[model samples]
Target: MSIYVGNLSYQVTDEDLKQAFAEYGKVKSVQLPTDRETGRPRGFAFVEMETEEQETAAIEALDGAEWMGRDLKVNKAKPREERSPRGSWGGGGRSGGGRGDRRY
Candidate 1:
């Protein structure tokens, strides 16, 4: 299982997250998602530890702790939900049929 860390500073790196959690126990992995359009940090991350005890310890110690100028929100991550594929028009609205008014 992985841990969800929210309210992180944009400047926080994967290494920073790993180091912070390492104090409790072995850190398996750290992932920081980025904005697809701008490629910027999303201010949140996921951390995986070696054992549940380590995870619980990290969560308890860092849940409300201040780090990198922001209060952390740490907890177990929920499973990702499945999403349907987007349409060719980007799935914002109706795909077929135009305005139906054309000048001859």
Candidate 2:
């Protein structure tokens, strides 16, 4: 089972997250989202556990709990929506025509 954790402090690290949830159960992985340009933590993360019991435990123990001066939000992660690949210009369009169809 996987969970989405949000409202994190910028200083929060994967180790901190793991330690917090470790008290409840085994954490399979912890992923903190980072800024695309600055590469700094985006103040949210995702945690995955091997069992529903573990997930439930972590959620019950951590949700709305304060950590690093911020309230942590824990809940089941939603499935990622499929996105189209980049540069997928499948639409029919034309551009940069030199004065065509114009009374130049």
Candidate 3:
């Protein structure tokens, strides 16, 4: 299981996360997603450790701990929910009216 690290500073990087978690144990991987529009860090990350014991230790040590000027929210990541495809207007394409409805 991977750990969900939240309330991170925008400046945080993958290597930074790896280093922080490495103190507890071997860090398997770190994923920090970025905003699609502005192309900036999303202020959160997912850290995968080599073992559950190491993951637990990291979570206990880091949760609510102040780091990078923010209180961290570290826990096991929940399974990502499936989202429906979005349209140009950000809707789920449920609205029927569109360019096809206009007949000049």
TM-score of each: 0.82, 0.81, 0.82
Against the reference, the lDDT scores of all candidates come to 0.93, 0.90, 0.95
Better of 2 and 3 by TM-score: 3
| Model 2 error, position 95 (Å) | 8.5
Per-residue lDDT of candidate 1, residues 8-35 (tens digit): 9999899999889999999999999999
Candidate 3 lDDT by residue in tens digits, 1-104: 89999999999999999999999999999999999999899999999999999999999999999999999999999999987777645756656887788767
- Candidate 3: list runs displaced more than 4 Å: 88-104
lDDT of 2 by residue, 1-104 (tens): 58999999999899998998888888899999999999899989999987899999889988999889998888999999999999997765655545575654
Model 3, residue 35: distance off in Å is 0.9
Candidate ranking (lDDT, best to worst): 3, 1, 2
Q: Model 1 Cα displacement at 23 (Å)? A: 0.4
Question: Evaluated with lDDT, which candidate comes out highest?
Answer: 3
Runs in model 1 lying further than 4 Å from the true structure: 88-104
Q: Give the 10-residue window scoring lowest on summed lDDT in candidate 3.
A: 86-95
| Model 1 residue pairs with clashes | none
Candidate 2 achieves a global lDDT of 0.90
